[model samples]
Target chain A: MSGTDDNAIVAARNFVASLPHCRALGMVVEAAGDGVATLSMPYSEALIGDPGTGVIHGGAISALMDTSGGVAVLSHSTGAAMTATMDLRIDYMRAAEPGGRITARAHCRHVTRSVAFVRAEAFDEMPGSGPVAVANGAFALERATDP
Target chain B: MKRPEPIQVVKQRRDAALRALMNGVPYIRFLGIAFDRRGDELTGVLHYDEKLIGNPGLPALHGGATAAFLEVTATMTLCWATLWDDLEAGRIDVATLSASQPTRLPKTIDFTVDYLRSGLPRDAYARARVNRSGRRYASVHVEGWQDNRDRLFAQATGHFLMPPRA
Candidate 1:
């Protein structure tokens, strides 16, 4: 890989590492590129909603998508700036397969002066397979100012 | 302000039924949400638990936990309201509801959450209202707040699948 691309990946990873919520949820940055990012969360018994079903709770899926959306926003960011989600909508298509790692990929579809729009989807085991949940979000971006 | 005597009497029974159902759900227990009844409405509380912290930098509550708390609250509110309606109509007896699970648990079809402010670490509160409910579907809106109700940390709207009442 080119040095510039490698540096961008490192920067992206470092940025995610700085968020406590991402770390607490066991979310890992798989890969990131201009306006796109992928994150994965491993299966854990503690995250199950229905012990009878053993499927991960919908809340866990929501957090994964929200985090993925933020990372995607960062990929397209021009400089270091603070970002927070203004709103997020999640549509649960199906339950995640039991005992499988779930991955979410988000793309920053567009950015306005005050907001960044993102779309994300979560899948189990494979990225190309059917998605377990899909989400669209808008994030408020505050650009850093020069001192 | 005081409610009418007949309404008050019915609410007492309904609130007790809802509390019992809330305690039976495993996920509700896991989240440690407590229900409070105000007339015909319900409010849920999520007390501070270190394990629920998602944003340690802000020392904030986990966004997922907040969403789950609201989702469960909305479901429970609909269940309670439906049961009250059935009881008033003499379609189901209070004994039947208290003795067994409700006809069915509400399933979420879609959920949308709006983050207005960072959820600070503390006992968070949420209240839900069923905008519309039918035999096959229900729509609910919920708001999460801390300290001041006027300032919400997050608000969510969701559509849930409601099974036909037996």
Candidate 2:
């Protein structure tokens, strides 16, 4: 990795770790560059929504997607120092298998003056099963003010 | 002839059943969100905890946590509604639900969250309204607020696939 890539990765790590909830959920940024980001969270007992089924909660998956989407916007070429989720629509395709890491990849599709559009997908590493959930989101960008 | 159930008895039974249902979900327990039951309505409270902060710069509640809070509220509301008939008929009660774990909450089909405002670092409350529910499908809308009911920080609409009746 080049110096700039190292800096971006560091920034992404800091950006992700800053959120306590993300830390609590054990999210790690696997890669980031050019308006894209990939993050993963390990399966843990605390995230289980149903005690009997032992399946992870949809909320945890959404949280991972939401954070990853926001990070994607921040990593865009015209990077903004800050961004917030304006709206997000998430579809649950299926439940993730227990004891597997869930990974989410987000792409920053478009960026205008004040808003950036992003799409994200969360899936288990298991091949052929496809995504566990997919999301389309719009995020607000914050630019620096004039001196 | 059997006398009809008194109002206090009904309220107690409902509260107990809801409590058991809430406790059954490990995620809800992890988030420390508790439900407050009113007559036919349930309010979800995401109790403020330092670990919930998303943007430490602003020290605000994580948007994801807020989303989860709203989703949990909507889901429990749907579950309660589904079990209402059984509750009224006295076929289901707190003891039976806790013992058997018979009630299976509906599976979420899709959910849309509109972030109205940044969630402040404090306790948040949410209530859900069922838009449509039938034999196999249910749609619900939920709103979350902190200090005042009129001012909302977030809202969501979710579609759920109801489980088969036992």
All candidates: TM-score: 0.81, 0.96
- In model 1, the clashing pairs are A21-B54
Model 1 interface CAPRI class: acceptable
**Segments of candidate 2 deviating more than 4 angstroms:** B1-8
lDDT of 1 by residue, A101-147 (tens): 99999999988877888999999985566999999989888777734
Q: What value of lDDT does candidate 1 attain over all alpha carbons? A: 0.78
Candidate that would win on DockQ: 2
**How many clashes does each candidate structure show, in the order listed?**
1, 0
Query: Which sections of candidate 1 miss by over 4 Å?
Result: A1-5, A8-20, A126-129, B1-20, B23-30, B51-55, B85-103, B164-166
Assess the local accuracy of residue B165 in candidate 1 as a C-alpha lDDT between 0 and 100. 59
The lDDT per prediction is: 0.78, 0.90
